[model samples]
Target: MNAGTTAERVYDSLKRTLANGSFAPGARLEPARLAQELSSSATPIRDALNRLAGERLIEMRPSDGFHIPRLNEIGLRDLYRWNEVLARTALRMSRKSEPTGGHHIAPIDAADLFGFIAASSGSGEIVSQVASANARLAYVRHVESSIIEDTADEIGDIATAFWQRSISTRMLIQQYHKSRLAIVPTIIELIFQDTQTIR
Candidate 1:
């Protein structure tokens, strides 16, 4: 394989691991070990790790190597809130426009959405795939009308800006996963809420 393909593989492998929770928050990423695991040289591993660091998925330390970044409770809440608003806004905008002939909005399955986003973004095939994933997830939540408890209703108007255009179905899927990352903390909080309510 070419260098570019190798780098892409390395990047995809790392991202998949992160998304699947195989590597927990603050887990160390040893370049040597990663290279061995991926059957690649350290160069590509370093490159992939660096890219992940830039995405805020991993932390880079001068002397301590790389670790996954942790999302605190407050940060996680904000993430979920931001996505909810953005997604709703995008859905509203999509409704306003006339659907072109042959244009279809399919009901997106959760597993498919995750797989699409992982492949699209990790492969570096298209930048918009990330945004598309976000939209799809939002659509799912909106369709279910499940109010994400404990999230702020004060969604900023900026979300509407992202919704004004006709984003590809693929990008909508990507956006879904990206937004899912934000509300991870809320999911944990919900478990506690359930426990308290039950008692």
Candidate 2:
């Protein structure tokens, strides 16, 4: 394949690994090792890492190379807060007509549900930001499912409210973030344990 294609492919793979918490927090990402494992040259791996760093998915240091960002308690809370704000903003800006409840009860993935809410705003910028936040929080949400009993129900409620155009949908979105915020420590602990186990 061409150089551009190779770099793009490497970028996608690395983004998934980082997003899913495959690497432990603050783990160094050596492009040479990644290139060997991925069966590509180090150049593309470095290129991909640079792109991910630009998105804030990976941290790049002049002397230290690349690493997965370690989200502290405050950082985690701030990320969640940012996502909550983005979701609420999207909902408020959406001019979509009231839902007819045609597909209100269909099963929905949590990330996709969030995407739907964001896309409703009719703003490409908002959609892009929400997608990035969702990716960054993907593994955190997975940890939530393992620890929180009502995650599915909570997400489902939000989806239902959106489809039904309930006035309380906004409230459900707030509650969702509030509930997650309450368990930030537990989420972090589980994520750390999970990454440690795989090491």
Candidate 3:
């Protein structure tokens, strides 16, 4: 077991840890240490780090090594803003003859819901970046779960419209995204506070 494991397997495991925020932003991702923890060798860990870097979840420094991307106000805003644009494009594209039904959606989970929309965007880059950003936002979403829950209805309506092919309601999707901007300011402040306490 010394040679230890597959790169793809290591990548998946490390990605889960990163997505769950087990490793805070800017935390060094030393392959040797990670390999030791995973009961493997550094080779797979290095491979995993490269894959994570491709998704923008980790940064590879020139002289240093891999580290999680640092979270900040600018980065947080960029994540939401980009998610909005990408998700909007995806929803519009994924829009076909919507299924007819009164199926109810679960309460709002911005990270997850928007991740779904972005997944349909038909663009690999868009999907990858959005997923990475959502992973970063998962921790914040957990902390501010209540403040964001108010979006449940609006988001549900948007999802319902998408499902039912209701043109009238479908147009409301843009408004849903625009309305989300209002919370960005507060989110910015919260992320700033949260990152400050990280170290």
Candidate 4:
């Protein structure tokens, strides 16, 4: 493939790896190791790392180079709250718009559910912001499932409220974030535990 294609390919691959929580939190990302693992040169790996940093999926330090961002309890709570705000903004913006059809029940993937909510706002910018936040929260949500019981039920309720455009939609959203917020400490501990065992 061409140079641009190679870079894009590496970027996509690296983005998924980072989003999936392949590396431990606060772990330094060695370009050479990633280059060997990705079967690409260091240049493309660096490029991809730079892109991921811009998305806040990873951190880049002048002194230490690239590392997975360690999510602290406060930062994690803030992210959850910020996403709730974004989703609520979308819901408010779309209030006058009629809810679309296809309201059948299905397994609610957290990312897709949030993305759908954001898309309802009819604002591309909100959709993009929610998408980014969802990406960052992907692994944390996975950890949450282990810590927080009834996750599927919670997501299902949120999805149902959203599709029906019920008056309770906003309340459900707030509850969802509050549930996660309540367990921020436990969630952070489990995340680090998983990092130690798995990564």
Candidate 5:
């Protein structure tokens, strides 16, 4: 394959592996092993690792190797808060800019969100899937990070519950148009503080 294609393949494979929890936090990412597993070459693997490192998904240690960056509880909370803001903004933009030629623009459902993410198999699909998956993965990463930090057990379940409730609240806001946008950040802060306290 071409260099670009190979790089894309490497990037996608690594992203999927990271997303699915295959590469745990602080796990070393050996370039040779990655190239072998992905059936690519070191060049493409290096390119992919660089890209991931740029995104803070992985870190390049001095005199060491690439490892998944570990997030503390505060970092996890900040990540989740960012995700919530971005997801809400994306949803609002999607709703406002939907095509008008009798094209139905439905609010994103949980199943649709999950399926869109599951079907993402390449870098091309990343932009389309990132909003949802980032929102979801933020929670997952928060829980896992919390566990590693010894801040909490069963934090993933709490994050999942918060996400479900947020989805419902979004639906209600769309249907009723009664909720203020200011409430979103408040809700996020409340949930974050509550989770921290519960831990």
Candidate 6:
């Protein structure tokens, strides 16, 4: 393949890896070494790193290269809060006019559910952004999930309620916040984990 194709391929691969926390929080990513790992040249590695950094999956420092960012709990909470609002708003606005057959039930996982809800906004950009965020938080979510009470069923139930018209949008949003708030301790532990801290 051409250099450009190689770079694009490398970018996709690295985006997945970085999002899945393969590099770990605060890990240093050297372009040359990463290029070697991917069997590509440093140019493509640098290109990929820059792209991931743009999505906030990795941090790029001038002259210091790429590093995995330490999770900012406060920032993350704010992001989650707003993302919920957007997704909830989008869901509320669309459920009335959109086709009901397709959205009969929510996805089993939180990320997919959020993506599905965002898709209701009729914006491909929202779906793509959610997918990227999903990748970055997949590992952390997995860890956090293991220690916390699983509420997948509750989320599904909420979706069902919405689908059946048994609940209002306001109620759905409130339950979403409640389900998330229930896992506070697990998230707190995750944020302070030694591996998650910026070195």
Give candidate 2 misplaced runs (Cα > 4 Å).
97-108, 195-199
Per-residue lDDT tens digits of candidate 3, residues 125-191?
7677777777876665655554666566776776666566567544675675555466766765665
lDDT of each: 0.52, 0.82, 0.67, 0.84, 0.52, 0.69
At residue 173, give the lDDT of candidate 6. Answer: 64
Strongest candidate by TM-score: 4
Task: Tell me which of candidates 1 and 4 scores higher on lDDT.
Answer: 4
Q: Higher-TM-score candidate among 2 and 5?
A: 2
Clashing pairs in 6: none
Candidate 6 lDDT, tens digit per residue, 6-116?
Answer: 999999888877655575566788888888889998888888888888888889878877887765666556656666666666666554543345546557776766776
Clashes of each: 14, 0, 0, 0, 0, 0
User: Per-residue CA lDDT of candidate 5, range 93-113, in tens?
Assistant: 443222223343332333233
TM-score of every candidate relative to the true structure: 0.52, 0.87, 0.72, 0.88, 0.56, 0.78
Judge candidate 4 against the unseen true structure and give its global Cα lDDT, from 0 to 1.
0.84
Candidate 2: tens digits of C-alpha lDDT, residues 31-145:
8899988889999998898888899888997899998887778999999999999989988997667432344544355677788888778899999898788778877777888
Q: Write the per-residue lDDT of candidate 4 for residues 32-150, one digit (tens) a residue.
A: 99899888989999999998898888999998999888888999999999999999999989845544544554546778778888877899999889978887888788888887788
Better of 1 and 2 by TM-score: 2
RMSD each, Å: 10.0, 2.6, 3.9, 2.3, 10.2, 3.3
By lDDT, the better pick of 1 and 2 is 2
Index of the highest-lDDT prediction:
4
lDDT of 6 at 184: 53
Q: After superposing candidate 3 on the true structure, give the runs of residues whose Cα lies further than 4 Å from its correct spot.
A: 1-5, 62-64, 95-108, 119-129, 143-146, 151-154, 168-180
Candidate 5 residue 62 C-alpha distance from true site, Å: 1.5
Give the Cα error of residue 117 in candidate 6, in Å: 1.4
